[model samples]
Target chain A: MELGLVHYLILVAILFCIGILGLIISRNIVKILISIEILLNAVNINFAAFANFGDLDEAKGQVFAIFIMAIAAAEIALGLAILIACYNNRHSIDIEDYTSLKS
Target chain B: MEVLQFLFFGMFALVIVISALGAIFCRNIIHSIVSLVITFLSVSGIFILLNADFLAISQIIIYAVGITILLVFSLMFTTTKDDNKLWLAFAPRTILAFVVAGTLFILLMFNITNKFTDFNINPKSFITKAPKESTIELLKKQGTTPIIGKQLLTKYVLPFEILSILLLGVIIGAAVIAKKDTNEKNRASESA
Candidate 1:
């Protein structure tokens, strides 16, 4: 069957749900970062689909997605660096174990 | 009726889903990074489908090539190679995640169904327009990077400047966090 707009939206929905599940369930910090990427991709899918079906302002959505990717790159860089420092001091990368920053 | 479009869409969806799954489920951090690269590429395909070829190429270059390599390099330095089981305890929280995500999905479906019922399905006409030659051709017609450069320098100058400041802050923060604390510990030892 030919995929319609609804199909695309449904796919995005499922992907968003999966991303949320991964983010909440995964204890690995790197996995959490990956899940966040999945979530961002879901948002990008929605933006592109709406732009395609309803608006000629597709370029705007694409532009915003590019910004998001840039921000994500910055976040991953800073986050992984912090994780490395934490690992050096604590000898582990487990989020549960990083309780010195908690509270 | 269009075979190529159908095939492209199928392939895009398949690659996106598989790569996303691999990114989530992979035990190795490096493998997860690789899967993320694939996911970025698939999203670029979706951008192409939306007639944003410039965005597609930028996405491939920035995400797949630039960011992924940075991630791999940082991971190599930080994490141990042999110790693969890096996950923390996660049993109790997973159930909560499922419940929340399921409820959100149901709510989304309800909203979409209601909205779609009220709206008549009108196939947008602009998408049927003949595809332009390429982004390069359009850029050539419009005098390429000058327009973007002008806009960035004028209209978006504040955000542009702020972005550079943000990058500088990140670099400083990363340096501070990643710095060895041996000197401080030695001071403490001497005092003790």
Candidate 2:
């Protein structure tokens, strides 16, 4: 068999699913954040691959990927700050500690 | 050329998957972060293989350098306890998560393989763009960075500007939220 877009898609799917798994099972808020990053990276790979293989007039997918990276950076910064505040209040970063927010 | 492409793809794929798994399952948080760094690097390699030189460079600079540094700094700042086990194996949702993830993976694999069969005849035309000539030939004519720049300024100018404002807001908001206000601290201590 020849290598094609499907191979890249398959890889992205695996990464995305594992990211979900990580998000589900990790108690540490930081680990959950990392899992979210993994999910974003998987989407980025999909965008980049589409732009790479497709014969578009412009690299629209790559541009989308760039935007995604910027947004992800901003998200991480804000999220970490929130985590810091949470830590200061509760003295722990575990998601389990925040039971009030669950409902 | 085909053999070389296959070899490079295989190597990068292996490196990305292994390190990504390591990042997720490592016993130590610091080790997990290190593995994530490696995974990010290998992902950049995959971007390079896709012929997205500008994207690959941005991936390295944005993800490997900027984001990783932020993660490490946050990891250091927030948590002082040296607890190694991060996984919630006993959590009630853990089994549900596994089942959902496993089913999703299988569904994706089946659909993708089916689509691959249908797309095999002319994989290039499966998505969009007929490409009268050839994709690689066209990509070779114009540099990726300049094209991306032109597109950003012309077609995507609004989003480009919006991103700047969003970034500015995020920076200031994060600073304000993370700061220890005297009033809040006093109230918090009084309540405690």
Candidate 3:
């Protein structure tokens, strides 16, 4: 079958759903961050695909994808820092253990 | 040529899906990060297939190497032996996650396949002017880096500067948050 815009969209949608599933169901803090990265990647793929098929002249979608990658990097940095801080305080990476605010 | 492209796409897509699943479901946290690296690499491969060479390279650099290393170091500091069994949650949220993900997937597929027929039928109609054949050939040959650089410095310079500022703030914030509490340590030493 010839590849089309729909093929890329389908792939992205599937990845996005997997990201969402991992984000919600994982009990580890690192796993949750990985899921968030996966979700950002799905969006990046969509942007690149649209740039290829729709707006080849200016390539704005590709530019946006680059921006998103930068933001994801920043996010991961801060997230890991927070994870390390929380780990130092609680001495646990399990999401269930950090429920001090649950009362 | 087209057949080879399709084959590569199939391979990359399969790897992305499988490794992404493994990234989340692996019992070992280290194993999960390894799977995540594989996923990021294959996603970059997908970007290459989409003719985004620059983004693909940065994806490998920023994600496959940079982010993976950050995750691994944090894992080293935070992980315990008990973490192996705590990979997946068994509470009520697991069921909710399944329901939500499944519903979103179905909704997206529904819209993509049925509601947006014109997008697949003829993507060119969405754009006012078709890119010249020569420009397409040039882009295919030289890649999108030049165009991306030009646009970044010209049209998107504001966001570019803002992103640099954001990165600076993140660097400082992360250091402050992760740094050892010197005051507490000093007090403990004095008391001892």
TM-score of 3: 0.94
Give the CA lDDT, 0 to 100, for residue A80 in model 1: 78
Looking at model 3 chain B, which ten-residue stretch has the lowest summed lDDT? Answer: B121-130
Q: What digit string (tens of lDDT, one per residue) describes model 3 on residues A1-103? A: 5677777888899999999999999999999999999999999999998888877878999999999999999999999999998988898888989888988
Question: RMSD for each model, in Å, please?
Answer: 4.3, 2.7, 2.2
Better of 2 and 3 by lDDT: 3
Error of 1 at B83 (Å): 4.3
In terms of docking quality, model 3 is medium
Superposed by TM-score, candidate 1 places the C-alpha of residue A58 at a distance from the truth, in angstroms, of: 7.6
Instruction: Sort the candidates on lDDT, descending order.
Output: 3, 2, 1
lDDT of 1 by residue, A1-94 (tens): 5545665676688788878877887777777777887887788777666655554322445445556666777787787788788778787666
Docking class of 1: acceptable
Quality of model 2 by C-alpha lDDT: 0.82
Clashing pairs in 1: none
Better of 1 and 3 by TM-score: 3
Model 1 has how many clashing residue pairs? 0
Model 3 clash pairs are: none
lDDT of each: 0.71, 0.82, 0.89
DockQ of prediction 2: 0.64
